[model samples]
Target: MDVKTKMRPQILLFGDSITEQSFRSGGWGAALADTYSRKADVIVRGYGGYNTRWALFLLHHIFAMDNRSAPVATTIFFGANDAALPGRNSERQNVPVEEYRDNLKKIVQHLQAISPTMIIALITPPPIDEKGRMEFARSLYGENTMKLPERTNEAAGVYAKQCIELAKDMGINSIDLWSKMQETDGWQKTFLSDGLHLTPEGNAVVHKEVVRVFSEAGLSAEDMPYDFPHHSIIDGKNPEKAFRVQCS
Candidate 1:
């Protein structure tokens, strides 16, 4: 393929609703795309309300080993739905804590098989605001809703810690959103939208963490080449020359 037309390496964001919403206005995924604009393609594959168990079956379809466009890096983010409380949509999304950790290991192993060099990052589920989430849940399920919320900050923290531990065991990077977001007072009001989802400010937090992790993994933006010369730097008289990727 012509160098100019060559496919760029990808940074895949794979997860559930949080990942799905990562490209929303002022979202972390959008920020990453802009930051890596000419360097790498930031692709998102998010399945709303999906747990790790459901994700396992679909992983092969998303990252076929035969595909030439292998991702340079992949973020396997889950656990939010997996942390769902028993008897509250448990049949649909909940997974035991031990199983949750094991599923994450399986995911990493699968990615390693696809490409041993592919950088993997695991993101712990962000903390949930039980009060706010319960309110939201009540609104969705009516006043007759159950006593406990579908997800809770405490439960999410447990899963988050496991994710961090899993990352250490697998020798991959991990982002502890569950702990970082709650470090400050009134974090729930500032960072979360409806107890479960992220607010614009929350997205910013994730964006910063993503950059931090990517940098630590030696994938700094400064080190990556722009896909093409900046428009301002292009010669107006011969723009095509600027557009062409020079053969080394």
Candidate 2:
């Protein structure tokens, strides 16, 4: 690496609560921030309870309102909220799967338009293995009446596989962390108490997976551990009363 050779620009990570945590409160975003030092500035634009439309809306805002003065590289994750119908806990698994793929493609297109050299990583959502959660989903949709499918680990898997295929078709970079996590002895060991979000250990796993992807892609970023302090779930929010980190 020539001293004169400019390092790749900072990575701009965009997504929902997951990415948001990496930025606003600090999770993988913080890990990347710490490991990369000043080489890259990871801008996390995250929103809780936001779907693909909202993520795209934020992306547009970043483009039209913020800096285009500097070029950007990115890593993206979404689809957790999209799988659920707006304002409803039931799986919007009803929405044509193709539409989900299209929304993400649009997001990718927007990133490309902003910076052709941008590297985007599409991470599949982590596993949701809460026994109570499945019942809750069933109750939310009254699916028992219709025999709607149980809270799906498959839906996220399907959506992510679609993204991987999309990336392949377009010749881009992505990491199927979701698939890999499935083999991690699962959420039983890594999840926060809530059973939805990740514990630091879980995020550490996510970090390692991201590192594997970036390093293999030959992106310039160091490999480091992902361990951030637990963030409080204040504001009387977060549905799961038991939801707080309990990492291994």
Name the top lDDT candidate. Answer: 1
Q: What is the TM-score of each candidate against the true structure?
A: 0.93, 0.71
lDDT of 2 at 242: 28
**Model 1 lDDT tens row, 118-229:** 9899999999999989788778889887676778789999999999999999899999999999997888979998998999999999999998899889888888887667
lDDT digits (tens) for residues 18-136 of candidate 2: 87776434377788776666455566677765667666667677765345443345677776666653333445433445876888888888777777766677776665554645555
**lDDT, candidate 1, residue 108?**
92
Worst 10 residues of 2 by lDDT: 224-233
Query: How far off is residue 196 in model 2, in Å?
Result: 2.3
